[model samples]
Target: MDRQLKPNPPKRKTSMLSYWTLRYFLILCIGFTLIAAGALYWIRSTSIEKSMKTAELLGLEIAEKVTGPGNRLLIPPDIDMLVDKRIKLFNTDNYFCIMVLDNNHHLMYSRPKMTQDDVRYHLSDDLNAPRNKNYAGVTVNITDSNETLGKVWVMQSKKSLTFSTETFVIVVLLLAALILCGWFTIYWLSRKLSKPIRQVAHAAEQIRIGNYEVNLDIDTKEQEMNELVSSFRDMSIRLKQLEEWRALSLAGVTHELKTPVTSIKGLVMAVRDDIVSPQEGKEFLDIALKESQRMERMVADLLDYNAMSAGSVAVRHERIDLHLLVREIIYQWRITCEDKMPEIELEASTGTQYAIGDALRVQQIIVNLLNNGLQAMSDEQTPAFRIRLQAEGEHLSIDVRDYGTGIAPEDQPKIFERFYRGELKKRRTRGLGLGLTYSRLLAEAQDGELFLASSSPEGSIFTLRLPLWTPPDQHKREQTYRSPVNA
Candidate 1:
């Protein structure tokens, strides 16, 4: 049975604007709810306090009007009429009782004809008293010449402080306005941030599909946004360049490796078939061997280059004499390839200058440099390139100056990139372009650097900077060698 794999369900997502607006909305709802509760509490408590104070004043005024010059009570009908008119002055909802008491606290008169218990209820001062359980009351004494004649008592239900319709509606409208403003602010700011992110994501999709030419027309004054756009654009441009070099390297490496293999095969077949004399066959076999060696060198170069990037290639950190090492490298190179050799000069600074690096890797870097400088110039051009070594501060600087046809301004910047072949190298070389890139990686692994100090029509100066060997560096190397990790 052929079983098929099922596709996974897509994950859910929320947009930035909606996400932020909803969060802000929730926060605003909670905040506004608390604010509304507090406002209602304050309004109710204030209304009750102010209403009680006004009620006390009204009672005092009514008592003044009803009593005569000696604080004597008015006629019954007149007292009832004055009390009724004064009752109308209060709030529409307040239900109150007014009564009078003589000097001995005996009830003399009261509206609604209250009993003795009612008078006592209204006169009680305790908060939990019979009337205090549901009503708010105030009592005032009427006196003249320091003699208490009577008392005015006022009482009203506490329900009069309930919220009115107009106040409720006004408070609700204000809270709504604040929430609306908060939602709009969050949405506006979120959209501003999200638009650029969306554009970058779209460009990223373009890159995923192998389209490196991405045009971003976004403009933002924010510092972080500017940095993002700039870095992305730079990365896209670099990828495009790397893609071009990848294609060229694939073609070049394939052809360069295939030719030697094909040549060796044909040469071997010719010998086996007895197509030539034994003497000529021996010469052909030697040529084939050299060709095979060339092929082996190219393959090794590729493998070592990759291993260096993976940190799998073991590199020895040692103190090496630059002057002696440079001399040995040039001597071996001259002995191997003596044709078209120029009169080369070595300029060494005073003293035995030592630098910290891998001796074999240093030889590799110097040989590569010499090959590049020598191949750059022909007999017609100035045969003037020098190898100079000197100590600069705590570092050793070795400069290889070539007065050949100088590197082009455009091509100089990319010379150290892997598999990147400049115009000169493309025309004159027959292997992968990894010499400069590998040299730089090797230098950096030893806490050093390799760079082009200068390149123009006059010539190019390639400088290798390595740290000066000190007593501390020697101790560190010894420790590293003795580490158990090596075992």
Candidate 2:
């Protein structure tokens, strides 16, 4: 039994939940990160450009105010008042500086008065710094229609941008929620799918340990899944049945061979020891020889069955007139049976019954059926049966129906099981019950089948179906089917 087992498979101990959820988690996180990075990039670029544009416009406005219609400088007091108010208002939610320089490179006006070094030190190019720290300067030329009067420099920094925007916040929350929901759903589905498979694996383990009584009643809401469970359950049941049959078959084989060996030993020893007179000894020797022959037949049946199982027995396939074959087989069997041969009414078809099969195997199957029917009526004074031959679909069916008390209802289904002898057969016969099982195997080996067609108290019919032969050119070939008796 241990030798029958397949090699143990290598293991990767990972739960399906973790395998799927973690992998998807990584994928979703990567996707979210890329999207967030892209959105932030767009927002930062837009904010930097917007702040620069606003500063450029402010520089133009300041230059326009600092100049008169003829492009001359404004009065210092007027410039002071205008510059102070404008700078204060612009810097309310912003950080910027305003400066006006003359055409001779002299600083004419500076808001909050800073030197060149102070201006340069306060300005920065770091785009991601705080809005007040990341300052840039935009210089707009102060000019009339013909000549440049002065320049106005507007220093401004970018507005702050963060993930705290209301729309972006809402989208992040929604994305997080969707990712969590999707992961949870995937986890749930993985559990549902893996649960049955895990159960089946466990059941297989139980079977490996020779326990076939595990009944899994899982109701997975999938058609193929339910079928898988159902098939496993059925296979376990069949394995258990076959196991039981195997034990019974062993016991039956042992008991049957033991009886003949014991009888032969006793009879032979009695004659050798002169326990009986010459005439009685001769008769005893005859009985011993018959018993030995019976044992040989039993052993032969066992050998033949084993050879067939090992695929060492080859069967020939050829076209033969089944009608003629059956007639000759019955004739040869009747010669052996002599006076006790039962009446067999052969009801054959009028037309030829050509079949593609092994002739020897066919003879064996028909002979086994005849012997089974004959032995079934061991108690009857006049045993009888009928052989009905007919064309059924694409096969020729030979039904060996017996008129004796039919097979016991309980035993009918198992008659073809190896070593399964009925109660009546057990009482009347002294051989291993392999005839029907072997005959069925032979029938199947030749692209044929044997089955009990019907059974009742009054009679039983055993049928053998043989494949009909057709010529290679897709037409029926004719053979004159002659009965051996008529011929």
Candidate 3:
């Protein structure tokens, strides 16, 4: 069946405005709140300092004007008049009370209608102390030519400071409210902007799980998000196309299977009918067997690649001695290649060389490398292959080297790609081209890595590194063995 090809779709870009709006609005709100708080504090502090200074100046002025021989130790009538004028001024200016006291702690003068006796007593006691201190009352002592006449005390109401503090608190609360409002605004805006993205993510997830019919339901009024949804929808369509293509490829591979089986069946029937010589029939049977093996290997590799791609491959993990594992793999490969007469080499350090890994998978990786090395040198006059193992720190390294015709620079990067055949167009051996890819995948699944060290005229070196393991008991045994015998 003919399949339809889908066109590539453009990617959707996120809106720059959304980010800018949130960032700038939050910054402005914070800036305004901080500036407002700082301004209010400065105003309150300046106003309080000015009020205290004004009260001090007035007290000094009254003290200077009221001091005399009669005023020195006595209450003068002019002093009373001056105190009354100051009291009227203070009251009009929102001050609580004003009082003038003699050196004898006598309230010589006070504000009119001052029924609160506690105010007067507090002032008297505050001024009579040896050291003048301003508390609730900002006291200023009156002295004439170094003679203590009395003290002019300006008592500011606790209400004024209370009012200022309360005002500051209210301003702070307003700032907090503003911050809260900004947070709400940002949250609401982010949610609105993210809604379409969430939908697109859901659709993509559906597609990921093999749902090719998933479609995005998004509002086109939001231009940017609409574009994103459209792009995702297009991606879904392309994935569907690829899935169909894969089905077709599998069908093609299956159809191809029939030709070889038919050829083998025809050859077997011809031999039964005695249409060819026995030797010729034997050759045909050998070819048929080789072709069958090729088909089996191809199908097996395809299944492995599919399993790996689907993330369904299970790796059996356990603590394995690297030295023993490498030795076993080398021995098996040497036996398999006994007729080829390829040279094999091993190098390792003296230690436990233990690693947490899957022994079978490690053996598979070694086998794949050995097979590749052998194939690369099949045409050479004297094919030689070497396998080396070395321990370094917490890692064990395996190097597989071959003295064959090296891979071309252009083919080096794609050598590990599935189904990729290098510069040698006519394959020397029947392979599904998944050896290196499967080996790399198996290495990665074990928390190890595989990479081509170098490819030159001297051939290629593929290195494999797996993490080493050290048990606590082995460490204790080594420590005990190192202890002095005399002790």
Candidate 4:
């Protein structure tokens, strides 16, 4: 069946700088505008209230002055003479007009006597009359010994009691200036922050497309941004290293598998075709068996490495005596490599050292390291392998030393990389180049580390470190609480 390739959807361009800048500008403008408007309204209301209160106080004083000697409300003809002199002597600029109206809605006395049209326009018989836009009015009653006489009306001009249009315009302009400054600050900050983030995202895209050469040379004053760029650069370098190793592994696998299979095939065909005598045929069969063993070993190494990489191998932790484990593994190796065998030595502390790890896995790691050491020593050299065990406060260190030509300085750094074979010219063995890789992975999975401790023209020392195990009685408590049933 054919598979359909779907095109990726186009990405929409977004400007975080523009988005946050506009939001900040609008919020500041609205907030400040409301505050300014509220302040203006309060000032106007206070001024109007103060003016009305002053008008009332003035009316009371005028009423006392117009009171006659007998405490009577003098009629309009008598009031006319007393009111003009009293108003002139105690007048304020707060109110514009004052008038006295009797209970019958007749205008009895007024400052600057009004025409008929003016009286009709200004007069109101109802107590709850709505105020006009041009004036605010207050009414006070005149009383003589608790008897109603007349009503006094005081009107103040709106022009004096409220703010002008010019004043409001000035306040709005000032608020706009502040809002503009805020917008500019927001725009500057957004640009400064988002530019580096955009560059990081762009570099990530380049990496996703398999371009490992992308450089994130961002110069930011922010510490967090600097750290982010540094981490990305490290990731890019690691990916490049893995890419190179993958290519080398592919080539090595083909070569390792092909050599053994070709030898087995050629020998079998030779024996079947009667190219060799009966005795020679038996010898060829023996060589073929060895070649088959080589092939099996290569396939097994590949399977082990794959299983580790897939995380399918579970580690069962247990207490094992480190020195005895190494000695047992060495004994097995001695028997397997009896032909042109390497002499294995175990130098360990007299005391038994216990470690926490899977015993089988730890044995696997040691066997692989020992095999690599054996392979390093050619038939011409006096083969010697040493396993040294030591305990250093809370941890155990195992050193596997081989008496062979040491690894070159250039190859030491990548010695543990998958399928990496150093000193290829000296390697006359037939096997996949994943021994060190598998050993390193196995060691790490068991909460241990494998590293090259030292190397020289004589030999190289590889060290493995694992946590020292404590007896159950000496172990620390993990929990302090228990269930009721357990208790």
Best by TM-score: 1
Candidates' TM-scores?
0.81, 0.78, 0.47, 0.75
lDDT of each residue in 381-474, candidate 4, tens digit only:
9779888899888889999999877788999998887777875522667666788889889889988889999988798899988888876664
- Candidate 1 regions exceeding 4 Å error are 1-11, 68-72, 75-132, 142-151, 262-288, 339-342, 379-385, 402-404, 454-459, 470-487
Candidate 1 lDDT, 443-481, residue by residue in tens: 898889999999887778999999888766544663221
- Candidate 3, run of 10 with poorest lDDT: 478-487
List residue ranges in candidate 2 displaced over 4 A: 1-12, 53-70, 73-113, 120-180, 265-285, 471-487
CA RMSD per model (angstroms): 5.5, 6.3, 14.4, 7.9
lDDT tens per residue, model 2, 1-487: 4668788898877877678879988887788778877877787777667666766777787777777766687734676676657656644343556667677645677776777655435543331122344555577888877679987877654443222356578768877887788778877888898889889889999999998889697998899999999999999999999988888889889999999899989998999999999999999999999999999999999998888878888986777799889888888888888878678889986977788787778888988888877777747547787888898889989999887667988998888888889888888877788888899889999889999998887778999999987765536544444443454
**What TM-score should be assigned to candidate 1?**
0.81
The C-alpha lDDT values of all candidates are 0.78, 0.79, 0.72, 0.77
Q: What is candidate 2's local distance difference test score?
A: 0.79
RMSD of 3: 14.4
lDDT, candidate 3, 1-487, per-residue tens: 8888887788776554466566767796879778886887677677667667767777777666656675464446676576657757754245455667677766665654353465444544454432223345567778766677777776565346333656678887887787777767776777777777777777878887988888576775777777877888888898897787667555655655665677778878888898999999898888788778777877788788889778899885567777777877777778878888767777777765777677778888888887787778746446677777777788888898988777889989878866666747335664556778898999999999999999886788999998776665754532221111122
Candidate 2, residue 120: the lDDT equals: 39
Better of 3 and 4 by TM-score: 4
Off by over 4 Å in 4: 1-13, 53-135, 139-152, 157-160, 258-292, 351-353, 425-431, 473-487
Error of 4 at 294 (Å): 3.1
Which segments of model 3 are wrong by more than 4 Å?
1-266, 473-487
lDDT at residue 233 of model 4 (Cα atoms) = 85
